[model samples]
Target: MAKAQDKEAKAAAKKARKQASKERRQQLWQAFQMQRKEDKRLIPYMVGLFVLIVAIFVGLGLLFGSVWLLLPLGIVLGLLAAFILFGRRVQRTVYTRAEGQPGAAGWALGNMRGQWRVKQAVSGNAHLDAVHRVIGKPGVILVGEGSATRVKPLLAQEKKKAARVVGDTPIYEIVVGNDDGQIPLNKLERHINKLPKNIDGKRMETLEGRLSALGGRNPQGPGMPKGPMPGNAKVRGMQRTARRKG
Candidate 1:
């Protein structure tokens, strides 16, 4: 009976994995279609990289008199390089489109991978300007999106609130935009990742617990959409697939 149960569990797990793979492939294909419309050079760049990598490998194989042995390896590497290029182009296109949209910073933060915790629209106003809070190894981060004029105040208020609860924990403030001293939406993730680590996993958890009492402001505040930006549903799926495969 135990053997039969184990076999069934293995089969179910395999089926679930296959289903996930299928979904990922579909999402990637959709992303490719959307990206190619705006990214004319994407294909050319991928093809060029693939050809260049394969040519270099072939040349080395010939020099070593192992053309047959290296040919397969070269082909595999070339394909991987091309796929990486495709994924990068898709990501660029997505970020470009998402930039400046309401809650774009929150959307980006929500997708970040790691031990970070994101709270979107922690403080927002009628104009859709909002501040998002992120807690990670680097401590607390308050990211504001929308008009600089309004977001600045929102960031300040939220930072003050967070400081009250976080004590000595570091609190970083960032405004997402193209303006001087502001992090662009596409580079927001990288900027956050570069912050100096100020806490460990246990410390982070304690910080989070303390801040939890602060809670988030009304998410349904004026002009805030309850879900992702319009037309972003498909793009969101593609983003996940690209992150996994990239």
Candidate 2:
């Protein structure tokens, strides 16, 4: 009886994994279809990369008199290279589309994977400009997105509020834009991650708890969508999938 139960459990787990795999593939297909509509060069670039990688490997194989042995490896590596290229292109496309939109910085911050405790739209105004709060090893990061002129005051205001609660915890303010002093939306995550680690995990948690008392603002500016714009969230998922599967 135990053996039968164990077998059934194994089968169920396998089935679940298969279902998840199927769903992931479907999501990828959907993303590819969506991206292809706007990015005509995606397939061509992928194919070109695959061919280039394979040709290089084949050349090396010929030089070493091991064409047959290296051929399969080459094909496998070529496919991987192509997939990674696809992922990068998808990521770029998503960032490009999402950039400059109201709450875009919050959306990007919310998507970051880490020990970060992110609160989006912590402060904003009627113009849809927003300040997002992030707490991590680097302490507090206030990322503002929207009109550069409008966002500066919001960042400063939010920074003051954050300082009142965070005390001496290192607080960093960033504006997302293409301007000289601002960080681009795509590079936002990298920039934040590179900041000096000023606190430990325990301190970060304590900081988060303290900041929670400060509450947050949800400015539903006219015409501001409640979540990421259509297709933006889906593409972000595809970007993660690409990074993992590639």
Candidate 3:
């Protein structure tokens, strides 16, 4: 009797998960449809990508005389190509919408791959000038976004504060924008990734604990929300799908 009950519970759980997944996909599709209305090039781009992928695969299959074996493979590869193109388009859309918005830097930092602790809006002013802090194996990175003149001072001040806590550890400063000395928004992740890894995992943990003592304090106001920007549900869905595929 207990074994039968367990089986029933497992079946019910599976059904619930399936329903949830179906609902999520529906939401993602609806969101994608709405975005498509504004992004006229999206469909054409995906179609082109699919055709290119299929052509390459089919050509290779014919050359190898494995048309039967590779036909299905071609279809699968084409679908994946389209899906990846969709994700890239969604990412570009999200970034375009986020550009010049307050807390945009924080949003970019949140999307960064790897285990970095991000503290947003650690300091800011009425003009939306803000400083965000990140701690990782690279040590401390202070990112300032807003007017360069105003943010320069903010970054300097934040650096001093962080240095006090992280004595001898590297503290890098970056300004996100398209100015002469600033890194572009799209390249922000790559820039962070390229930073020298000065500390190891154990040092990272110690640094995190030390910084945690600083606690949360928003001088201007609360930082940007921790995850994807509001109204970016479709982008979030695409990100999940891409991650799963990866």
lDDT string for model 3 (126-147, tens) is: 7878888888888999999989
Per-residue lDDT for 1-246 in model 2, tens only?
999999999999999999999988998888788778889998999899899988988999999999998889989998988878877788788788888677677777877777899887888888888888899999999888888899899889888887887888999999999999999989999999899999999999898898888876754455444346535567777776765675
Candidates sorted by TM-score, best first: 1, 2, 3
lDDT of each: 0.85, 0.83, 0.79
- The clash count of every prediction, one per candidate, is 0, 0, 0
- Can you list the residue pairs that collide in candidate 3? none
- Candidate 2 matches the true fold with a TM-score of 0.89
The number of the candidate with the highest lDDT is 1
Candidate 3, poorest ten consecutive residues by summed lDDT = 221-230
Superior by lDDT: candidate 1 or candidate 3: 1
- Considering lDDT, which of the candidate structures 2 and 3 is the better prediction for this target? 2
Q: How accurate is candidate 2 locally (lDDT)?
A: 0.83
**Model 1 residue 20 lDDT?**
89
Deviation in Å, model 3, residue 97 alpha carbon: 0.7
